[model samples]
Target: MSLKVECQKEELAEALQLASTASRSNSPKFALKSLRLGAESGLITVLGCDGEMWVERDLACEVIESGGVLVDAKFITSLVSAMPSGQVALELLVEDGMRVQQGSAEYKVLSSDPQDFPEPPDFGGEGELTLKFSQLQDALDSVLYAVTTDPHRAILTGVQVSYDGATLKLVATDTHRLAVRTIAQEGMGSSLSVVIPDRALRAIRSLPVGADDDVTIRFGMGRLGVEAGGARVVAQMLSGAYPNWERVVPSEFSRTWQVERDQLIDSLKRAMIIASESANRVKFSGSGDSLVLTAKSEELGEAKEEIPMIADNGQIEVAFNGRYVLDCIQQIRGPGIRFELTESTRPGVIRPAEDGDDYFCVIMPMSLT
Candidate 1:
């Protein structure tokens, strides 16, 4: 027996985009595979993955006949995404494969053994609290930059998620810098800690955006499962405990400065133009009501800029990687930002002055040798 399905072009396109990241080989697997047709609910389960990440989408389909089969995810997705935006029909072919038809265009794609595909990791229990899609996405976007790509330290490779009933905090650090973001949730729940893979978080960002409903995140056993929009994602959680980041963040600072976000970012960019390759160092000197940014390179020329700042403490000077400081500033969402420093050698904290349950970035000072 054969099966037929009709779905919107956009839905298929988005699903393909999310699945493309999961392809394991040089010739990427199809974006749609492991299709299971359910006669009772009129929903078709579409599964795709490479090995590390897996995504599943359930689409409402008019099943002319009740049956199921596996097809290449890449072929189906490419064919559907390239087709004009309209209804597309997928028919099971007798040759142990499937045929996709859109208007005058029709293509046949080979099938993979569905039973060979790895099963998605089971997410045992419901999450502690559900969060809005926008909130989660925004928080991730604000802090993902600080996640370490360095493989030497495994803990810094992923984002640390901490939840304590009232607030959910996501933190990532690379030793040189750290980014911490907090968001408010509705329900009260027990405290939970989980380190989610950076690749999985990036995959979540690619999922259909602007979803009104809350996304369900389940952390149990060694896996984290996220269900949002009409799709679901399952990934293995990073093993081992994250570092004691709180201790690394300085508690008090000798000097605190508040400056415009754009101005600081612009000055850093200009200074970085001539910064040394070995150490993208930029100097920051605080005075009465202004801060000076200076960078000099042996090969290139030196550049300096003076920007007005709201200095509350005594004058101080610190050196840091301009790229790291600019990365933290770019993640900030507001007009004015606060920078608290303890000494020229200690780490400094950068956070928004207004209390809106946002993000905080901490940067370690570099020694000038």
Candidate 2:
């Protein structure tokens, strides 16, 4: 028996986009690089995985027959994307392989054993929370940079996704710095928390979620799953407790300065060019109504920028990893960026300079030397 399904070329293209990232093209396990297609009553589901990340996207189509096939993700994706904006048909070959056809063009591609594909983890509970796509994506963009890239520090490579009764929060830290953002939403009445690999969080962004749509998150059976935008994603939870990031955030402030967001970023970028070759450190000195940014190197030279500021308190001097400050300010969209400092020895926060905002970053100060 052969599996068959017919779908619009654009529909197939969209579905392929959602599943393509799960392919590990260089993996020794060929099945891991393939897309698993399962056709049932009236819909066709495409599944892809790269061991750590997985995506399952459903495409609306006419299922001429009900069956399944696993084909190379790259090959199928290329074939589908090149097809005309019309209908396309996919069918399993008589003896082996699968065939894809559009108009006069056709291609037969080798297949993998469907059973060899690893299944997505079973997420059993009712959805725990629902968040708008923009909300989650916004928070992810702000905090993901702080996720550590060190392989040995596996726990720091994942973001802590948590929800209290009223807020959904994402927190990530790399010991040197921390990022936290909490968005107000209503969904699950109780609290829920999970540490999800940054890789998996990236895969969720690739799933077809639109900026305005809502994404539903469910947790159970040692897995976390999200359903939205015609796709469902489930991944195994990273096995470790995230650090207590709250303790690292400085609660009291000795000085706070408000500066134009674009101006600060521009000044930092110019300073970064010189700092990158040296210590990657940028020092901030705030006194009276102006903040001066200075970076120096023995080999490359130094850069000095004076930015107008509204310092609320004491004269302060602090040095921080310039890249860290850039990362935090780049995510903030408001007109003004706020810098709250307790001392040159503690972490300083960069946040939108508005009355209230959902995002904030705690960057540790570096020594001038």
Candidate 3:
């Protein structure tokens, strides 16, 4: 069909950008690299999909003809972003081409039949969960970094979402480390859980929804759907059993060291300078009223820094991946951090000095040698 519409350049660009998240520019199939734009009732909806994931956004526009067209996602997004200014008009100038015009500049881009694009499945009706967009974003930030990048372990590449009556928890683990964040959600006593890919959560976090906007979440046909403002993000859910993160989290620790978050972060960064040359292993040992961070590299020399901390159970020595510890502390918003450990070999637990039991990270230890 043909789509004739005029919308602000910024809005068009943003819509295309959202859709481009799922569009595969390098895909061999043209439809997988293309996004469809439909004009109807003073609105232009842009949709893009790569078979598994899809993103759709609606923009208020002047619709002259009710129709649809498919165009290259990357080219269209960049083209609209570079438009001179103000409004950009889109219409079928040829049998198989789209004309984009802004000010005196104009370009006719090749278009494909909208029918060639796979339409996203319909996801409507009341959702199982509803929460503020900011709440979901905050929870996502705390755990996404821990999600595994390994494609082979599809389950570990996703965040485990579980809700039970009063609280919603998000858990992620890459086998080396685990991150968990819980939020207070009133009502809804039923318990449910789902594993959503990290990529999909990242796309949802990128949506330009208001901080106070309400986001609706729905699931169907083994797919998870998130909707907020005029945008919708949907993706296929991962299969197989997720690791029991609860088991990885230490139930009790014999020693706990309370230290300043910023100070430890700085110390780790400096130690990593040398530690990076040695598999990022940084030794943590007791030193009176403070803790010493030491990393030695035959080629890069050694780094040693001491930070004030109170450790219980006399003396403790442990070695961990410096980068892994840094990742956990960066997610801590509080000024203080607590490191809980039973021994050098067991996985150490880290939690913010504040927030009670709301957030924590469990990191596997490295060999001290």
Candidate 4:
């Protein structure tokens, strides 16, 4: 097969970068570390996969001859990115290699048989949900970090997505803490609920979705596909039931406190320094308008900081992993944060002080000794 193409260096590098996301960092199989390049009808498509996840990128280019070739993902991406900002030319050598040339520099990279590259499954299901890029990006940023990294619990490594035409909710938990965010959506005629892997969700979020772009999500053939920003993303769905997060959240709280978001985060960060060697426990006790954050460590001494807050329903004291609290705090956009507790031992619910805000998190209390 013969092929030749010319495209802007920046455009080619971006396309290869997208394809490299699917290529594993270390793989014994050469094909898994490679990306497939194909050209047809004045367009070049790059495909990459690592068995489970796959990516494709298409860009306009001058296609002199149509053919396909498999080239190392990292090598090709790096070569294109280092080239000068202008047209980069690629041609299939007579001896079955790819010749990439730009200006006075030229490199011939070996090409594997394109037929050996596993093709990605076609994704053509009817779009079940349509959400704006901002909304989806917000949801991902708010909850993706909470997904569990423990391989033993596969379900915890995925973000639970539930959409009911108007409201789309994303929830993630790592057993120690849970994050939930809901955003308004439009153009969804039916509801969709699935547990999508954290990696896949991250890939969708990283796509160049314009501020006005609407992402269409589809599910079929035991996989989830996202179409947005002129690209399509597909991944295998996690095959287990996600924990019932709603039930774990406190239904009622005996005490509530409203505190400045910055103040609380700063105090926790200082307290966390002392507890770094320990379990990172930071105790919170509040009465009336006074709140104190305290942490003690056997090897790192102790820390105490008082924060101003508005408390109701009497005094309350709770202990939590300072890191968990900090993680959730960083995601809050409002100036004030509201934390509610049923008891010191029960999980505490945190939300933005802004009423009717749909973002919240639950932190399981750490043991106090």
| Top candidate, metric TM-score | 3
**Model 2 Cα RMSD, Å?**
3.2
Off by over 4 Å in 3: 64-66, 82-85, 103-108, 123-127, 188-190, 296-300
- C-alpha RMSD by candidate, in order: 3.9, 3.2, 2.5, 2.8
Q: How much lDDT does each candidate structure score?
A: 0.76, 0.85, 0.88, 0.86
Flag the better candidate by TM-score, 3 or 4: 3
- Please write out the lDDT profile of model 3 over residues 1-369, one tens digit for every residue: 777888988888989998899989999999999999888999999999999899999989999998988899999999998876698899986574999988888888998889998877765433366778888788899999999999888899999988887899999999999999998877633466889988788889988899998776787678888877788898988888888778778888888788999999999999999999999999999867899999999997999999999778738899999998998899898999988899899999999977749999999999999
lDDT of 1 by residue, 1-369 (tens): 566777677766666557655554354443233332222156666766756568777777666766665665556667777888888777777875777888888888776445566667676774554677777788898788888898888778899988988788999998888889988764835578889888788887766647565776777777778777677788877889898889998877778899998989888888898885548999899989999998888888789999999998849999988898888778777898888888898998888867624778889999855
Question: Which residue segments of model 4 deviate by more than 4 Å?
Answer: 1-3, 78-110, 123-127, 184-187, 296-301
lDDT of 1 at 127: 53
lDDT of 3 at 204: 91
Over 1-369, each residue of candidate 4 has an lDDT whose tens digit, in order, gives 777999999989988988788887588888899999999999998988888888888889999999999899989998898887999999988895999998888899999788888877875574467767787787799998899999999989899988778888899999999999987755554687888988888788878679678787788777878766556678888887788788998888888899999999888888899978788888898866878899998887989999889888749788999898899988999899999888888999999999536899999998877
Clashes of 1: 6
Q: What number of clashing residue pairs does each candidate have, in the order they appear?
A: 6, 0, 0, 0
Ranked candidates, highest lDDT first: 3, 4, 2, 1
Taking all chains together, the TM-score of candidate 4 against the true structure is: 0.88
